[model samples]
Target: MMANPNYASLKELARAKRAQYGVTTEALNLIVVRKIYSDEGIRIDNWEFPRTIRAAYMSDDADPSVAINKTLPREPRLFSLVHELKHHYVDRPKIEQGQIKCGDYNENQTIEIGAEVFAAEFIYPETEFLERLQLLNIEPGQCSPEDVVRLKRECRACVSYQFLRKRLVRLGFAMPHAFDKIQFQKLEEQLYGPPIYKQKWFQRRRGRAQAK
Candidate 1:
């Protein structure tokens, strides 16, 4: 596949690869990425990358590897890993030949964007995302930041708010950057309270006691 491949083509390729790997939508929703890497025999290295570089793919005939930024939150790390998988599949030859670099966003814009498209589709198909929005009664051009936060909480897909925002913009559910200024994370915490892990110790203890 050439650089700047169309979105449809990239989506098809991603779904095909998912099938080949026996990765179901449920698995993707849960972010079972490391298992995929292990199954593919791709080595994973969690290293500290510069802020601008989220991950890199290194292709080798015997052992392909991906280095991800260790500091990235769970969702972005999962996205980056899948992004490198695109390079491993379609851009390996170019990467190995030094014609393309996987992590450099400044160069190889076409391939980088293509990888992003592939990653997004692989992580959560557009059709499924649309269906989810419909199930939640979220309409095009009328989605609110709070609706997005609820979507994140209710949807099984492990995606960042930025991911949801971009999808909304692409699907005409919202204008570009409409949610950029909104701190979805903070809002989520405000609305839903902190995630279970961050809840107060007494709250956790109470929950555990209630569970028994």
Candidate 2:
């Protein structure tokens, strides 16, 4: 029987894969998931998957593919893509033999957790995250919701606040579920106004009104 990989091993594997794919920290900040998929020859289809199913991967030797939930926002979609990539790399054989399954993570807890670890590390490595926090002078137990917003704004990684919060908790930087009830999007908007697209749309509307 194969030994189940622990978190540290999974993280190392993820980092190695990142290196193999030439994924640098700068690339991660720019969100290279789709580029990585193209490089790996994995086809992507955005479908309206069930809410419970964020994404699914099929390791078909002839044509490997990943189907992601179209309704997921940008950050989640990127994360899910990387999550499926993990399965593509490590769980392909088990998946092919029907020894593992997707969607329902509970059935394959260890593998699923490993995939999560891989995705997280691949997207935003812990060392970089810690470095960013330290640069910002954020200490353990000192991160506030506002600080989290700042982190997201400054970090440049395409990840949700939930992802950041969970990472903080996992690294003992913050208490678990400490920011669960905070509506991060709402807070972000309140702090920085609307997102760039919305600002652009509003500017366009004003320009049209002035011309009229």
Candidate 3:
């Protein structure tokens, strides 16, 4: 019999969902994240924070349902949930024995970046995100807030549009050299800046060096 799947393999999960279930990559994304997170004792929500939260809880098993804070923007929430998902990505029940403290800053910084990558790839499939955006007649130039609202709604992305746009760039679908062509140089004026990743490249590289 095949072994039960773990969160360790995003590539595998994506492939399986495609070959086995015939699900779209996006839907496979949701399935993989939900499966990995649920096993790790993290609660996946439908409408709560929309992103996620991962504080150091004092238990072997986490609470079944995490609070859904609707007030926060979806970008932060997605980042948060993605963060928690990474905790499991490392080691689930074994790590949860409190052998490793859950949600420590050092640990969080280590794990969250990968989760962000996973989430970004999942939410913004390189081929799909670019095509979808093209269909909307939208480029990343700072559209009016009204346009932002309309574009996001059209994409069914109620979360942060700019945030997703930046994620697209990181995933290599966005044309960074053509940020001006996308008209973002002018539009990015509204938001303070690009979407932030959890751990920086420098820190990640430093850690990898140490590990090696």
Candidate 4:
């Protein structure tokens, strides 16, 4: 069994999907129509799970069904939908036999991690997303956290602020540590609405750094 997923290959898989579907953005319709699962006749539906389990795709006795937690916000729900679809790419046999459980989907396990990467890149194709950012006047090495916020709202793209930040770093739009103390605090507040512990920690850190 492979210990880690081939990220490059998975990226190529996403690229291939883009080329095949003639879509510049994520082809969610493929998953909806069961085409992305290839010839498999998996059905998509909404089944509310516990808060932790956002989605599940089961292939039991050759009966495949994908259930999504509809309570999730738009971005997370979309990501989880893709994450479950990625299981078909990661382990076909296990998925076919109902041996795989994507419960701990957020964990660092190889399959889970691969699914996360697949979902993110699938939703925001790197080149097209970069072009979208560029159209917003946000260029590589020139974008700020504020620019990302504006883009998120303008594009109406479903992605977390953290994901947006990482995407910016990946695309060379910002340095790894580009958002400083104040900026990071502002971003956190904007996304999550004033985290208690993080607020105190950032305050102390900002004070000490400013004193320096």
* lDDT digits (tens) for residues 112-167 of candidate 4: 77777777777777766777886899877988777876776666455766677777
Where in model 1 is the C-alpha error above 4 Å? 1-5, 29-31, 102-105, 202-212
The model with the greater lDDT, 1 or 3, is 1
lDDT tens string, model 1, 1-212? 43444767999999998888787665673237888788888999989888878888997665799988889988898898999888888888877886765455458777888889999999888888989999999998999999999888887887889999998988889878798799998999999898876879968798899999
lDDT of each: 0.84, 0.84, 0.48, 0.68
Error of 4 at 189 (Å): 13
Clashes of 2: 0
**Candidate 2 residue-wise lDDT, 38-110, digit = tens:** 8889899888877888888886655789988889888788788888888888888888776766555557877
RMSD of each: 3.9, 3.5, 15.5, 11.2
Q: Candidate 1 has what TM-score?
A: 0.87
Give the C-alpha miss distance for residue 52 in model 2, angstroms. Answer: 2.2
Clashing pairs in 1: none
Query: Scored by Cα lDDT, where does model 2 land?
Result: 0.84
TM-score order of candidates, top first: 1, 2, 4, 3
Write model 3 residue lDDT over 1-212, tens digit each, in one string.
34323433653443443354343543443445456556556665444323444332223444534333555554555545544444454445545565556435356543445455555444444456567667866565433344443445466532355565565454444455434345543354444443233337767887899999
TM of each candidate vs. truth: 0.87, 0.86, 0.46, 0.65
**TM-score head-to-head 1 vs 3, winner:** 1
